[model samples]
Target: MSVPLILTLLAGAATFIGAFLGVLGQKPSNRVLAFSLGFAAGIMLLISLMEMLPAALDTEGMSPVLGYGMFIIGLLGYFGLDRLLPHAHPQDLVQKRQQPLPGSIKRTAILLTLGISLHNFPEGIATFVTASSNLELGFGIALAVALHNIPEGLAVAGPVYAATGSKRTAIFLGRYLRHGGNFWRRAGVADFGQPGFANRYGGYHGSSRRYYGGALRR
Candidate 1:
């Protein structure tokens, strides 16, 4: 399949998976959910530094100063636009249940999903365009975009699940997936199956130790 087609398929699959997870009536543990969000954050941070920024710097004989300027401008543009709009938080209800009546939950879910979809549209275009221009650049963009998207899935799923308590319905509306045997197997069953898996084997403990040790040493 073509690159755009592949990306579309992958995005669709992700949405479907998110939906399924929402519908499965399975509540992912707080730790697991937290880890997933952390993973997504790490991935986005890495991609921003390693891929997107560098790509912007290297575009077609552009001076380092000009490239960097453009990069800053792009960042500001995003920031400005974000500021102009009403902030949509997918996990708003999930984290803080101070407002939002039960009757309004579904409406909120729909609005949240719509917001996410609109936000991702430009990202999809950017990924497609970059991949079309350079394979490595495309890979980097895809990785970064995928990382950014994961948390969004959690955002959509968490609130819907919280409000409705119906996994299938949530999945249908939000397009998230529940963890199943097949899903776990695909994601590495042994890793997930192990107790304290993220802490023991996924860098959490080591990173924490280093961070705390540095803080104490300082």
Candidate 2:
């Protein structure tokens, strides 16, 4: 396989790590979830300020005004869309499930999934294109992007799992699978009863750690 494709796959695969955290045998305790959120949030904020933004400013021929303006636009745009979306909380989903959610709520989840998939599709393209253009930069970008995307797996899988109670669908949506047998076996969660590639990992993309973090809000 080509270098770009390889990098893309490796980066894409990190979601499984987050998914495992979110959807393993049991939901993490609230304290653990809170800690994960805090850590993830710290990573995101520090990386954005120290690495991502600086990298943008350093981009050849890019003016500070344009770069900062674009950054602000992204910030506003994310919040604007966040408000527009009818995202359900993983915690609240339990109560919502006991009482049948309006069709609109289900529709909201569907819409969120579609919009997120569309938005995240570009990540693969970005990784592929950048790797093709510059090897070192591509590796750096891929690593940064992949590290950030780990929470994306949690964001996607947790809400859906809470909403639907269907692990299979979550796995299907998360879209990466390789190994999980040993963990499951040790946890006594399941017995796959097979060998290599026996268990599946699930996750989603685009929403980021905020969703996972916010889901824990009391």
Q: Which candidate number maximizes TM-score?
A: 1
Where model 1 places Cα greater than 4 Å from the true spot, the runs are: 80-101, 161-169, 175-218
Worst 10 residues of 1 by lDDT: 209-218
Q: Model 2 lDDT vs. the true structure?
A: 0.48
Please list the C-alpha lDDT of all candidates, in the order they appear. Answer: 0.48, 0.48
Worst 10 residues of 2 by lDDT: 201-210
TM-scores for the candidates: 0.60, 0.53
- Give per-model CA RMSD: 14.4, 12.9
Error of 1 at 20 (Å): 1.6
Clashing pairs in 2: 174-203
